[model samples]
Target: MTSEPAERAGVPRRSLLLGAAAGAGAVALGAGGAIAPPAQAAAPFVKGADISWMPQMEAKGYYWNNSSGVRQDLFTILKGYGITAVSLRTWVNPSSDPGNGHCSIEETAQMAQRAKNAGMQVLIGFHFGDTWNSVGVQNPPAAWAGMSYSQMLQAMYDYVYHSCNVIKYYGVTPAWVKIGNETNSGICKPTGSISKPAQMTGLLNAAYEMSKQVFPSTPVLVHLAQPQNLAGVQNFLDAYRSNGGKWDITGLSSYAQGGNVPTVLANMQTIQSGYGKPVMQVEYGGPVGKPTQVRDSLRAFVTGVRGFGGLGTFFWEPEGYPSFNGYNSSAWDESSRRPTAAMDGFLNV
Candidate 1:
């Protein structure tokens, strides 16, 4: 779940292959023609950050400065710090609630294009809600609230299909597509609740299948929060397996408050072994003030995960600075208007 006080806060096979390869330092053609992908992706271990707050932040006059005090794009600064990929969040029909709104399909496409322009791989997450959805809250989009289970499944398919096409239209192909965000309890709740395992898995399967249809080679991730809860994670994945749900990867959100790095790492390894799926830390963050601690912790987590062949680790909203949607755990310093040492964790990783 987000820290906000307000509420919380694609492609063909041949072309798809090139897009994925482009994410790995190869040249691939996009709307703007040939572009080199991030070299870090070539390493095959993603060092990523979720800068989904960027569009809104820029709209609010927020910008970043390089280490030498030179103004630069946030993506440029992140790449300099060794970030190879970016994760973007999407909402069905979000409102303009500042902290809680504005990550609709259109905004997601624009951000994906910006990431592609910066030579970074992209990961797109679908919340399937008009607002925030996470372990604690999984409200169905208002438009689907009154629909039957069958109707909801169709809606999920259409939404994913349309969203993928928009991203493709923007000439950006995602390296990873997340079926749901932090869906520990299940997505599109009540009917799609964990208690209703079959129904829940059915909805997730719909999103997963739609993603495959659009981006045949892209991996679809099933994200859950708090890996420290081993039993909870197992139960969630077990439900998917038992219900015949499909997923290409297992993603997780592990914050400093959620558990220690070793604990999270161990749990992830166990899950990977038990489920036979690759794992990635899809969301993570540390206290902004403790730059050294944050840096060391992030470095340890990523290194440990990589040691075990874990896909990658991503810092959640690292571009978020103090007072941006009431979030303050960003790797950036508001006063300095530059990235804090915490971001250096990705350096040389």
Candidate 2:
């Protein structure tokens, strides 16, 4: 569940995977001639989906209405469908509420435990903002509303360490933890803006360091918005790594409405090879306007990602939209339902 894909205009697109695979079994036999195999294929890899943005706040009216029995039943449903991971977000502080209600530390821990108990890996999203954070906007939480530059940096470090500590102590440590959500603009606000890449890198490095210190075995993920921005992606990675940050995974937030599938796949391959780390499509989904269109886009996207040698991909919120007005339609809505076409693509490949 990434903020709408309204900010991904200038990214490049290339069909590296589909095109590269076309020449796999072809051999040059004569001048301007080649022999190709009658059959060609690509090996299958892991297929995982992300389930972040499930309503955690009861006041938001999107609470997991399912009882313990129902909750377990739903997990069984997902597992049977080949879903193997669950992602949840954590808010430092929410605007409507001071404490992290649905997106609190404790709530996330419980969700992680539930997913783990059901035999699914957990991916934790740590939004270093009060609410939404994306490429165009990445604001500090209301609690840190007036802190100075230095103070904010220290707070960011402390927050990461404290959060990791809690997760570790509860024995629900995430298999992968993102330092910040869709941090294309940067995180923790007035100080960590992308305008100052070095400053942003320093802040991210601090968080990464703290995360490692608290949970040495967990992988620290560095996420960016829109998979098509080649320059932005490379710039972010170069700055982040140069500033002493250590990342085990390169995560991307992509949406079908943002651009063409070929462009997204091409950019993903570039990043994956450039960083030498497994790439994860941390967030992706098509709007519910047309079910078939959405399903087809998802299928192509998933297949393209795997073809590019991606580690795994996760769908944003296959459950339902998080209503800002406090009325969640259901634990999972029809618009976000698991389309058979999309599910087949994931399960088969």
150, model 2: CA deviation in Å? 2.6
lDDT of candidates 1 onward, in order: 0.81, 0.62
The Cα RMSD in angstroms, rounded to one decimal, for candidate 2 relative to the true structure is: 13.6
Candidate 2 lDDT, 1-349, residue by residue in tens: 1111211322122132322232232112211222111111122344456554443433344332222223335566666656788888887765444222346665566667778888888888888876667787787888776887766666766676666666655567677788888886677666787667777876776676666555555667889887778888787787776765556678898875434878888889999899877687887765444445555666777778777777677776555543532322222443333333334434554
Tens-digit per-residue lDDT, 183-281, candidate 1: 889989887999999999988877776676667667789999989899998889999889977776799998854247888889999998898777999
Q: Give candidate 1's error at residue 29 in angstroms.
A: 26
Query: What's each prediction's TM-score?
Result: 0.87, 0.75
Off by over 4 Å in 1: 1-43, 257-259
> Global CA lDDT of candidate 1, please?
0.81
Count clashing residue pairs per candidate: 0, 2
